[model samples]
Target chain A: MDEEAAKKLIVETLQKKKGKSKFYLKDFYKMLPDEKPRTVKNLVNKMVGEETLEYWSSGSTTLIGLKGVGKQAGAEDEED
Target chain B: MVEFRHKTPLIDQLETGPWTSFVSDIKREHESRMENPKGIDFQFNQDCCDDLLGVLELSYEHGRTHWKHGGIVGVFGYGGGVIGRYCDQPEMFPGVAHFHTMRVNQPMGHFYSTKYLEQIMDLWERRGSGLTNMHGATGDIIFLGTSTPQLEEVFYELTHNIKQDLGGSGSNLRTPSDCMGQSMCEFACYDTQEICYQLTMEYQDELHRPAFPYKFKFKFDGCPNCCVASIARSDISFIGTWRDDIRIDQEAVKAYVGGELKPNAGAHAGRDWGPFDIQKEVIGLCPTQCMSWDGSKLEINTPECTRCMHCINVMPRALRIGLDTGCSLLLGAKSPILDGAQMATLVVPFIKVEPPYDEIKETVIEPIWDWWMEEGKNRERLGELIKRQGMQKVLEVTGFKAIPQMIQEPRSNPYVFWKEDEVPGGFKRDINEFRKYHQR
Candidate 1:
C-alpha cells in the first residue's frame, strides 16, 4: 500500500475506536489484512517517527496510539 | 573528583553485621574513584558513589526512598534496554539526579573471558558508575547507574569495543537465558545454551524494541531440574525431557546399594543421615511408584514413569536421562505482578530441540506473540492472559491437540463450559419444549 493510503486507513481505524485511544500494532494489522505483516509494521513505525502516532509504554509492554491520545508516559514506567 | 559529603550514621549501622555490607563497597568505590578517576562526559562534578551514599543516608533518615522513576531513556533506534531514574532530592544529590540503568546482554551461560570482563569493567569505569550487579533477576549484566546524556556513548563503546549488545529491559522479550547445559553439566538432556543464543540472535528486534502488549520472557532449562528456574519465571519455558526409558546402570545401582558409592554425589558429607537405604529413599520416594528392587537388580516401570527426576537426583551415578531426548514447551509463566505468580502450563509435551529451532518458532512462539499482541492487555503478562482466556484458546491458537499432560488433574468441579456448537442442539433450546415435557 502507498504511504498516504496506509496512513489514512491507520488514522481512520484509530479515530473510529472512540473509547480506546491505544491499540496494539496487530490491531492495525487486522485492519489492513491485505498488506503483509512486515509492510504494516514498517508503515506504523514510519508513522510513529513522523509524529502521526506515539508509543505509550508500561515498561513491560508498549502500545501504539494516535498522537497525544490515551495514557501518557510518565514516572510510573518500569524501573530496572 | 568529589570528597565525602554526607555523614551517614544510619548507613554506618548496617556495616556491623556478619555479612559484608554494600555500604562498605560503595565507600571503597568512592575512595578508589577519588584517587584515580576514569572520566565521563557531562560531569556532574559530584561523585556518583558519594551521591549514592548520600541518597541511602537520606532514604534511611526519611524512612522511605528518595528516588523516583524517570521517563524513557534509551540509545538510538531502540525502545528498551535502558531504564531512566531520578532522585526526588536532586538538589542534595546531583550526581544521581539523572541516574539510569543499562542492561548488557551476557554471553551464553554467562561465561565471560577475562579479557572481555576487563574491557567491560574499563568501559563502565570510564562512562558510568563502576558498580554493577553481576547479573539482574532477568539474567542481564546490569550497569546500575549512569547519567542520561552518556547512554548513547556507552552503548556505542560497548557494541564497538566489547562486541556486546544490550539486553532487554522494557515490555519486550527480556534477555533469553539458560543454565550451563552441555557446556558444564552431564545431566543435560539437550544443549540449552545453544538454543538460548540462537533464540536471542533470532529475535534481536523483539529483544531491543518495545513491541509486545506486556513484557515477555524466554528461559531455557536443560532438564526438568530447571537450575535456572525457567518453569517459574518465563513466558515460554523450554525444558528438556525424554520419552524413552530412563537409562539405568544396574552395576552402579548395586554399588550404591552395597555402600561402595555415595548417594547425592556425596554432597551431604557434613551430615550423618545414617547409611543409605535404597528401599527407604529411592524406591519409596518415586512419585509414580514406578521403581522396585528385586534383591539383585533394580527395575523401573518406564511406561508409568513421570520423569520427575527425583530418583535421578538422588542416585546420579546409577540413573541417567533417556537416550531419545527432547524438550517440553510450556507457556505463560511469570512472577507475581498483575496476576498472581504462575508456573508455565505444559503445552507441547515433547519436541526435538535442534539448532535454528524453527519448529518451536513456527509452532509456538510466533503464533502466541501474534495472539498476544492482539488480545493481551496493556500490562498483562502472557501467563496472566492465558489464565484469563483459558488454555483451550491457547491450544486452538497454537494448533496443538488437547492432551492429558497439559493439566495437573481433571477439573473436580464438573462445571463444564459447554459451547453452543458442541451440543447436539444449540443453546437456543426452547423453554416451551421443556414445559411441554414437564407440564409445568
Candidate 2:
C-alpha cells in the first residue's frame, strides 16, 4: 500500500509542476506529508536507477521530471 | 489616538481627488449609524480602511475586481469572515501588505434585535473599525480593519455571545441572503427566512472550509420584481412564484371602479391609488398583454398572463398571486474572473418549496455541486465547467437527465449542446421525416 501511494504521488507531482527548472532535494523532500525523507530518497534513487523518472544534477542540487507522461498528466489551468 | 504600525503614503496622496469626497460621505454615513461613536473606539477602524485603500489601489492596476494573489486569513476550522490583503509595491511601501478585513453575514432583511445590534457595535468598536460597509456585494456586513492575531480571539467570543457565526469565504458556500419575505412583503410566495437560515445552518461546515474549486453563493427574492436582484448576482437563486393561475376578484374590481374601495385594502385606492385610478395603472401596464377591462368587469387571460406582480401590486384588492405557490431556481452567476460575467440560467422552472425543502436539495442543489466538486478546475465554477464539458453532461451528472426544457428545439440556442446518446430510440430526423410518416 505504501509503495503504491508513494509511486502515485511522485508521478502526479511531477506531472503537475511545470518547466525544466531544477527542484532542490531538501525543499522537494518537505512536500511529502506521511513518508520520511529517507524513504522518499530511497524511492527516488530506485526510480532514477530504473529509468522510470528523469533525474540529473545541477551544482549540488538534484532535479527530477516526468518520463514521457504527457498523455496521463492533466494541464493545470494556470494564469499567465 | 491609536498609533499605526502600517501606513501607505500613496493612500494620503490619492485621498485629495474623488476619494476625498467619497471618504467624507462614507464617514458621515458611518457616524449617523453609530449610537456612541466615542464610547468604545471608531478611530482604529478608520485607520484600517485607510490602510486597505492602499492595497485596493494596487489591485486596480491589473484590472478592476481582479486580485493577483490570495492571502485569505481566518480562525481555526473557520475560513469565512476574515480577508487578508497585500500591497503590490513592496519596496516602495514596506509593512503595508498585512491589511485585513472581517465580514459579518447580514441578518435576513437586515433585521436585528436592538440588544443584538448594540452588542455587535460595541464589539466592533473595541476590536475592529467602528466603520463598516452596511452590506457588501456578497450581502455581508463588512468590518473594515484588524490584524491577524487579534481576529481569532475576537471572532471566538463574538460568535459565541452573539449566537451567530462568521459568514463563508474562499472556495466554499458563501453566506446566503434574502430580502424581507413574509415578514414584510405581501407578494412573498415562499419562506425566505426559513430557507436562508436552514441552508446556512446545514452547510455551516462547508461555509467555513475552502474545499470546493471555487466559491458558491445563494440569494432569494419573493417574486420576479427581484428586490434582491438574485438573478444576476448569486450562483444559486430561488425566486418565489406560482405554478397555478393568478386569482382575481371581479366584485372587488367593480368596487375599485365605482369609487367604493378603501385605500388601506392592501394596495391601490384612487388618484393617490384611488378607486378610479386602477384601470389604466393595472390593466394598461401588464407586460404580457393578458388583461382587459369593460365598464363593469375585469378579465385576466390566464394562459397568456405571465406571473409578474404588476397588477397584484397596483390593485391587491382585485388580484392575488396564485394559491399553488412555489419557487424557481436559477444557476451559475458570478463576476468575471477566469471567464466573462454570466447571468443565472433558469434550471428549475418551478419546484414546490415547502418546509424542509428536501426536494430542492435532492433534485437540484446537491447533485449540481456534487458534479462540480468532482470535475471543476482550480478557478472554474459550475457554469464554466458546463462550457468546457457540455450542459448535456452537467444535467446528466446532476440527475436531471430528461428535462423537457433540454429536449426542445436544439438548433435555436447555441448553449444547448445536446449529446447524440440522448436521442430517442425511434426518433425521426426532422419535419420532413415526420411528414412522410404521417402520409403513410
Candidate 3:
C-alpha cells in the first residue's frame, strides 16, 4: 500500500481501538501486512517526526500513540 | 525561610566516630541552604535535606525503610534518566516524600574539568539534596535527591547551562562508559573513550527512550586488564585484545635479571619480596606455560599464549602488547539477580574496533536487539534472555560462527540436544520401525 493509505489505515485502527492509545512499532507493521516492514517503519517514524503521532516510553519499552492522546512526559504513569 | 531543626538522637550517634559521616554532609548542606534560603515551592514545605534526615531518623526508629518507588517521573520528551522515589510517611517528612534521582550522562572516561564539575554541583545544590554519587556504577553523575517538580528544572539547567544530557535509567540504553584507554594507560589496544563517545552519540534515541524489553549497557575496557570490570557488569562488553605475538625486549629482560630495573615497574617497591626470580616469577607463573627462559634470553610460544597479561604485567619494561590490536565482543553479563552472576560469554572472538563501529552495530548489536525485543519478557535483562535461550540462538541470529573461543572447554555431558534437521530421518520417523526391531 502507499504511504497515504497506510497512514489512514493506522489512524483508523488507532481510533477504532478504544481505551488503548499506545502501540508498539510492530503493531503498526502487523496493521499493514501488505506494506514492507521497512516502508511501514519509515512512514510511522515520519508521522512521529510530523507530530501526527508521539512516542510514549517507559524507559524499557517505547510505544506509539496519537498526538495528545496518551501520557506525555512526567505524566505519573506506573513503572514498567 | 524556616530552619530545619528536627531532633534525631539515634542518627546523631553515628557522628561521634572518626570516619566522616554522611549525616554530617547532609547537615552541612542543610545549614548552607538555610543560611542562603530560597522560597520552597514544592508541596513539601521543608528543604530536601531536612525531610531526608527526618525519614532516616524514622527508619532508624522503626527498623524499616519508609521509602517506596514512585510513578514515572522524568524530563520532557524523555522516558528515562530520572528515577522516581517517594516516602510513605509524607506528612511526617514532606521534603523527602517526592525525592527523585536524576542521572546525568558523565563524560566518556569521567575526565571532568573543575569548571564542569562546579557547574553540576551548583545546579544540584540549588535544586537537589546536595547528595551526589561521584559516579554511579553505570558511570552517570548521579544527582541523589530532588523533588518531582524540580526534575524538569534541573534538566533545563543541565541542558542549558552545563550543556549535558541525562543518562539512561529503567530499560533504555544506558550511558556507555569506558576505561582511561589512550588517556592514561599504555596497554590500551583501542581508543576506548572515542568508541564510547561515538556509540553514545550514535544511539542517543536508544539512550533517552525505552526501546527494548529491558536495560542494555555498553561498557568498553582498554585491554584484558578490564579496569572498568565490564566482563561481569555490562550487557555488552568490548574488551581490547591483539592477534599478534607479544613484543619482548631481550635487553630489558636482562636488566631485570641483573637487578638494574625494578620488576612490575616498582609496583612492589614498598614490599621486600627478596630478589626478583625471572624463571620462578615470570616464566613459572605463565598460565599457558608458553614462556621459557634459557641462560641468555627468554622465548615465548606465541600460538599457545592466551594473552592473559601475566608475564607482561610482571615485567612491564621488558614486554609489551602486540601491535595488531582489536577487541573481543562478549555478550550478556550481569550481576546475580535471578539465575546468578554471569561473566559475559565471548560472542565475537575479535573485531577491529574503529570509528562508527558499523561492523559491531550491524553484525552484532542490532541483530541481538531485534531478536531480544521480540522474545524477551518485560523486566528481563539481556543476559537473562540469552541464558533462557541457548547461545546457539544467539549465534544463529547474529550469523556468528561456532568458534572454540566461545567456550572454556568441550562439554563433558554426553546428553547432547540434536536438532530434528540434524538427524538422518528427521523427527517424523515411523514408530512401527522401532517396534519391528524391538519385537515389542
Candidate 4:
C-alpha cells in the first residue's frame, strides 16, 4: 500500500479501538500490505516525539497512547 | 606447574582453615589463568561474605571454576550474576555453608519466612558453605551454595508460599517497612506497620515488576527518632509527626528537677528530664537562644526558634506540642550515588492530611514514578536524578504545591534570622540565685 493509504488505515484502526493507548506502529504496519517493521517503529517514535502519541516500554510490546489518554499515570504507575 | 604459596601463620591463627587455602589456590590459578599475573592481596570486610557467595553462585552457574580464598569474590553479569565471599571461621556460623549467594529479584524485595530461612540454612549446612546472610543488601536472602540441581529445588521451595517479598533491587519499589511503630513506641504518631503492610499488599505487582530505569525505596518511621533512618535512605520516606501542643506536666517537671527522673543514656541521655524540667533545660539548649523564663512565666521566641522539637520531647509534661499540625514532606535526600552525601529536604510544608491516609501513597508514589520513568537513567538513584534535573521539575510533574517547608537548597541559604533586640536575657534568677533568694 502507498504511504497515504497506510496512514489512513492506521488512523481508522486507532479510532476503532476502545483503547487508543494500544495502537502501535506494528499494528498499523500489520494492517497495511508491504510495510517494514523499521518503518513502523520510526513512524511511531516520530509521533511520540511530536507529542501526538505516548510510548512506554523499552521492549517489543510497547504501550502506546494519545498524549493524554487515561488519568495521568502517577510516579508509582511507572513502576509497572 | 603452578607454584603454591604457603599459608601464613596468621592464616592458621585464623580458624577459617581450607577457605583461606582455597582463596590462595584461586589467586594462584588466576595468575596462571591470565597471561599477566597480578599479585594476590587479602582484604576483609564484614559485608563481603554475601558478595562472595553471589560471585561463586554466578561463576558456577556459568560453568566457571572459582578458586577459594579467605576473602569474598564475584563477577558482574549484564542482568544477573553471583557473588561469593569466604569466612575464616565456619564453626562460628554452624548453619551456613561455603559458596553461597542470592538471586536478584530485579525490582521488589521478595523473601520467604523464618521457615524458609531455616530451610535455606539447612541446605547451606548440608551441601555447601556453612554461612549465609539472609536478606541483607539486595534485600534477598543469601543461600549458601549447593549442587546445581539443589539450587532449583531450593529456589522452588523458597519461592513457594512466600510471605514477605524481596524488595526493590534495580530501579523499582523496594520492600516496604520492616520496623516497629506506634504499636510499640510511646512517640509514634501513626501506625507505621499498618501503612507498610498496606502498601506491600496494595502494590505487590508494582513492587515485583521491573519497568523503571532504576530502583526506588519506601521507608516509614513511626516518629522522628526514625529508627530506619528513612529520611536519609528511602526515596519516599514517611515519618510520624504531631501537629498538636506538647503535653507538659509541671509536677513531673518538678520531680525530674529534683533528680527523680533521668533520660536514657547514649545520644538522648543528656536531654532527658521530662515533663517540665526538660523545657527549662531547653533555655540553655536552644540553638537560636529563643527560650526564656521569668519568675512566673516561660516564653518562647517563636521567630528565633528553629522548631527542632528538642525542648518538647525533653519535657513532654512541661511542654505540649500543638495539635493543629501536619507532616513536613521532605525530598531529594539520599545516599551517595552519582554525587556525595545528600539530605532529605523539607519539600512540602506541613501537609494537613489525616493519619492512616492513603493520600501519602497517592501523592508521593505518583510523582516519583512519573519523574523516574521519564528522566531517570539506568542505575541512577531517584535522589540523584532529582538533584541532576532540579526540584522544580519534580514539583511540576508531581503536582505538589511548594511551601516554606520546601526550602530548596537550604545549605545555600542563610540561617533564619532574628534581631538581637528580641532576645530577653538575664531577667530571671539562675538556679543558684533562686536558692539564695529562698535562703534570704
Clashes of 1: 2
lDDT of 2 by residue, B245-270 (tens): 77888898877666676533544323
Model 3, DockQ value? 0.20
Per-prediction share of native contacts kept: 0.26, 0.00, 0.16, 0.00
Docking class of 1: acceptable
| Winning candidate number (TM-score) | 1
Output the better candidate (2/3) by TM-score: 3
DockQ of each: 0.26, 0.04, 0.20, 0.03
Give per-residue lDDT, candidate 4, residue B434: 82
- For model 3, the chain A TM-score is 0.84
Q: Interface-residue RMSD per candidate?
A: 4.2, 16.6, 4.8, 16.6
Candidates 1 and 3 compared: the better one by lDDT is: 1
Model with the higher lDDT, candidate 2 or 3: 3
Ranking by DockQ: 1, 3, 2, 4
TM-score for each of the candidates = 0.87, 0.70, 0.83, 0.56
Worst 10 residues of 3 chain B by lDDT: B37-46
Over the stretch A20-79, how does candidate 3's per-residue lDDT look in tens digits? 888766677679887654466567767876768766544344567787775544443223
Q: lDDT of each structure? A: 0.82, 0.65, 0.80, 0.50
Docking class of 3: incorrect
